[model samples]
Target chain A: MSVQDDLETVEWDVSEDAHITVDNEQCITCEDKPCLHLCPAECFDYQEDQEGGIYFAYEPCVECGACMVFCANDPDKGAVSWSKAEGGKGVEFDFG
Target chain B: MTDVAFDVVVVGAGRAGVAAAYKLADEGFEVALVERAKQPGMKNVTGGVLYGSILDDLVPEFPEEAPLERHVVEHNIKLLHGDAEVSIGYRDLELREEPNYTLILGKFDRWFVDRAVEKGVTFLSETTVQDVTQEESRAVVHTDRENGDIACDAVIGADGVNTTVGRKTGIQRTMRNEDMALSVKKVIDVGRKTIDQRFNLDSDEGAAYIYTGFPQGAATIGYFIYTFDEYISVGAVGGLETLRWLGDEGYGETGTPLYSLLEDFMELDNVRPYVQGDAVEEYQGILVPEHSYDTLPDRHDRRVALVGDAAGLVLNKGYTFRGLDYGIKSGLVAAEAVMECAEDGDWDAFGRRYDTSLEDSYVLQDMKQHRHLPKFLKNERMYDAYPGIATETLRRMYSAETDASGLTWRQAYRAFRRSDAGVLDLLKDGYRGLRSL
Candidate 1:
C-alpha cells in the first residue's frame, strides 16, 4: 500500500496553519534533500516543476522531529523549520 | 487570563512527567502536569516492553491495576540475511512472575495520568508549554494560552525526544543526526487466540521478537514485533546518521524512506507470515535517542530539570532497548530530589542533588555502563557482514543433501571463513560487543 493509504489508518487533528515550513529557496540550491526520504509519514516531496521546487504538507506529520535534527540543524542550510502542532492538533496514535 | 502557581510544574504527561507529578503531589506539593496531546501518550509510540518492576516505588499495585496488555514470557532474537536465518529463542515461566509487559502507550499513559490526578495533580490537557525560564526565586513556564505563565518552584521537562522544553531552556542545543533513531511503526490486530497459537503462549503470556540485518541498504536498522493481547506492534528503527552515511556511499538510489523500509520489513520472508492477515489498526512514527549516555544533555538548568527522552535517557544495546524504565526511574529520582529540597527549603540545590543522587542511582549507572553501544550499533558489519557469517555458516552445516551431509562442525568453520570478515575482525567485534553489552 502507498504511504497515503497507510497514513489513512491514523487519526489526525490537522492544524490549518502548517506546523512545518520548507524554504524551497534553500531547496533549489541544496544537493541532498533528506527530508523527502526520511519522513515516516511521507509529508515531503520534490516538486519537479520548471523551478524544481520542494513541497511539504504538515497534515500527516507524526511529529517525530527528524527534520529538526537532519535538515534544520545544519548550519549552512536552513531548508526546514519544525515544531509540534498547537496543543491537541496533530496525529493521535490510538495504539501507540 | 489569570496567572497560576504550583509547587512544581511537570511538562509533558508521558511516563517521566506523570511519575514526577504523581510523586510531588503525593508529597503534598501542588503540581501541574502539562500535556500537549488531547490525552497523555496520544503522541507517544513504542516497540516496547514495559519492565514494570520500577513502578513498584511509584505505584506499588501497578501490576494488578495498570492497563497492561500481556505479561511477556518469551523472547526471540533473529538475524536475517536473505532467506537464511540464525536465531535464539528463550522462554521462562519465571519471567511471567516478574512484571515485563507489552502494552499500548496511548492507553497506559492516560491510565497513569488518572492515578497522578488522584494524588492531586492538576491535569492540564490540551495546553502546550512554549518556553520555560527561571527567575529570581521561581521558575516561570510560558504556555500557548494568553496569560498562561505558571510560576512554580521547579519545572521538570519531560517533553520527549523532540523536546520544546529542552530547546527553549537552552539545556539541550542541537540533536545531531547520529544521536537519534527514527522509527515507523504499525499496530495490527490478529485476535488473542491467534496470538496464543502462533506464539505458543497461555492466556496472559506474550512474546517479543527482535529482527536484525535485513532491510538491505539501511544501516543500523532493526525490526521488532511485540504481542499485545489482540494487537501486534511491528516497526523498524534506523539511526539517521548511519542511514545518511549509507546514502552518501550510494546504498539506495536516494535517501532511505523510513515508511517504505517498514513496509519492506513486514514483507520479509520471515516477518510476513505473522502479520499477513492482520488489520492495520494504527500507524505511528517517533524519534528515540540513540546517543551515548555521556552525550546526553545536561539534565537540569537552575529550577528546570529535564527527564526521560527530553534528557536523552534512552539506550539501545542491540539485544534490548530501554527507555520507559529509565524515564520512570529518572523521574522518581528528580522527584526525590525535589522532596529533599522541600524539606530543607533549599530549592537552589535541586540540580546538584538530582545529579549527585542520580549518579548514585542505578539509572545513570546502567546508562554509563553501556555508553559504547550507540557507536557499536552503527558498525557496518552488524548489518552486512555479521549476519552473513552466521547465516552462511549454519546453512552449510544444515544442508544434508550436500556432500558434507549436515553433520560437520569443520564444514561450518569453513563456511564461516568464506564469508566477508576475518578471525581478527571477529575477535575485535567480539571484544567490542562484550564491552558494549
Candidate 2:
C-alpha cells in the first residue's frame, strides 16, 4: 500500500491549531527544505502557488520534534519554531 | 526556597518519572509525578524492547510486575543489499523468560504509574510543565495552568528527548539534527496465532530483526521488525542529517518518503507472508538521541536532576538499540540521589551523588565504554559499501552448489571482499569497529 493508504489506518489527535511555525525568508535560504524529507508525517511540501513556496499542513503531524530540532539548531538555519500542543493536544500514540 | 511543599517532583509520567517516583516514595519522601498526557504513558509511542540487566535491580519480580508483551529470545541483524540480505541470529531458551521484554510503552507506562501510586506517590495528570528553574535550594515547576505551579525541594526532569525542562533550565543544550533521529513505528495486528507460527516462537517468545542497506544513497538508514503478543512493530530510523540527504526525492528513484519506508519494509519478500493479511493498527513517530554519549547531561544540577530522554540516557549502538532499560536505570539512580539529598538536607551534593551513583552503574559505565561508537558508525562506508560486500561474499560462498568450475571457499570470500573496500580498508575499519563497540 502507498503511504497515504497506510496513513488511513493511523490515528492522530491534531491540535487543530499548528504548534509549529516556519519563516519564509529562513526557508528560502535552504532550498533543499530538509524537513520535508525528514518529517515522518510528511506534513511539509512545496507549494508553487503559495507566497513562501513552502506549504505546511500540521494536522498530520505526529509531533516528533524532528522539524524543530533540524531547523532551529542548525548553525546557519532558523526557519521552524516548534512547541508541544497545550494540554498534550498532539499526536496521542495509540500503541506508542 | 524554604517554602518547598514537596520533597521531590518528577516531570513526565513515563518510564523514568514513574520509576523515580516509586523509588522516592518507597524512601518515605513526598513525591509528586507530573505529566502532560491525560494519563501516564498515554502520549508515549509504543513498541521496542527493554534490553540489558538494569530491569532486574529496578523491579525484583519484573516479569510478573511489568506490563510486557513478549520476551524476545532471538535477535537477528540483517544487512540488506539490494533485494538480498545477510543475517546473523541467536536464540537461547533460558534467557527468554525474564530480564528482556518487548513492550507497549502506552500500557507499560500506565502499569508502572499505577504501581508507583500504590506506593504513596502522587500523580498529577494533564499538567504540562512550562519551565523548570531553580530558586535558592528549591525547584519551581511552572505549568501552563495559571495556578498549577509547583515547588519542590528537588525536581527530576524525566521528560522525553524533546526535553523542555532540560532545555529551558539550561541543564542541556538544544539538540541538533546530527545528534538526533526521526524514528517512525507502526503496530500491525498479525494475530497471535500467525505470529507464533511464522516467527516460530514457542509461546510468549519473540524476535528482533534490524536491517540496513537501504539503496546506496540511504545506506545509513536502519529498519527494525519486532514481535508482540498480537501485533508486529515495524519501524525505520535514520540519522536526521542522513535522512535530510534523501531530500523529498527519496532514496534515489524509489522516491520513498519516511513513512513509506515502513510499508516497503513490510512488503519485502521475506516479510510479505508474515504480515500478508495483517492490518496497520497504529503509526507514530518521535525524535530520539542519536547515541552521542554527550546526549546525556550532568546527572543533576543543584535542586534538579535529569533522567531518561531528558537526561539523554540512551545507548543506541545501531545493532543493539537501547533507551527503556537505560531510562529505568537513570530514574533509579536519580531517585537514590534524591533520597540521599532529602536525608542529608544537602541539595548541593545531589549532583555529585547522582554522578557517582551512575558512574558505578551499568548505564554510565556501558555508555562510557562505547563512547566512540557514534563516530565510528557515522562512516558512510558502513551503510553502502559494507552491506554490499558482506551480502555478495555470502552469495558467492553459497553458490558452490551451482559452480562446476570448483571455486574454493577462500576464493569465493575473496571475490566479494574486493568488490567494495580492499583488505587494508577493511582491516582499518574492523579495528576501529572493535575498539569503538
Can you write out model 1's per-residue Cα lDDT over A1-96, one digit (the tens) per residue? 767878889998888888888877887776766776777877776677824366788888889998889889887668888777888898888899
Displacement of residue B424 (Cα, Å) in model 2 is: 1.6
Task: Please give, for residues B300-414, the per-residue lDDT of candidate 2 as tens digits.
Answer: 6777778887777776686778788788888899898887877779987776688788889888788888988888777777877777776665666676654434455665566
State the C-alpha lDDT per candidate: 0.83, 0.76
Question: Per-residue lDDT tens digits of candidate 2, residues A44-88?
Answer: 777778545678887877777888787777757688887776765
- Per-model TM against the reference: 0.96, 0.93
The TM-score obtained by chain A of candidate 1 when compared with the true chain A: 0.89
lDDT of 1 by residue, B1-437 (tens): 32999999999998988999999999999999999899888988787788889998779899989889999898888888887778899999889788999989888999999999999999998888888888889888999877889998888888999888889888887888878888888888888998888788887898999888776424578888899988888888888865654444222355667677778878877878876654888888889888787787777877878888898988887777888888998899899989999998888888778878888888789888998877787777887787787666666666665565544567666766887778998899889989988
Which pairs of residues clash in candidate 2, taking residues 3 or more apart in a chain or in different chains? A96-B44, A96-B45, A96-B46
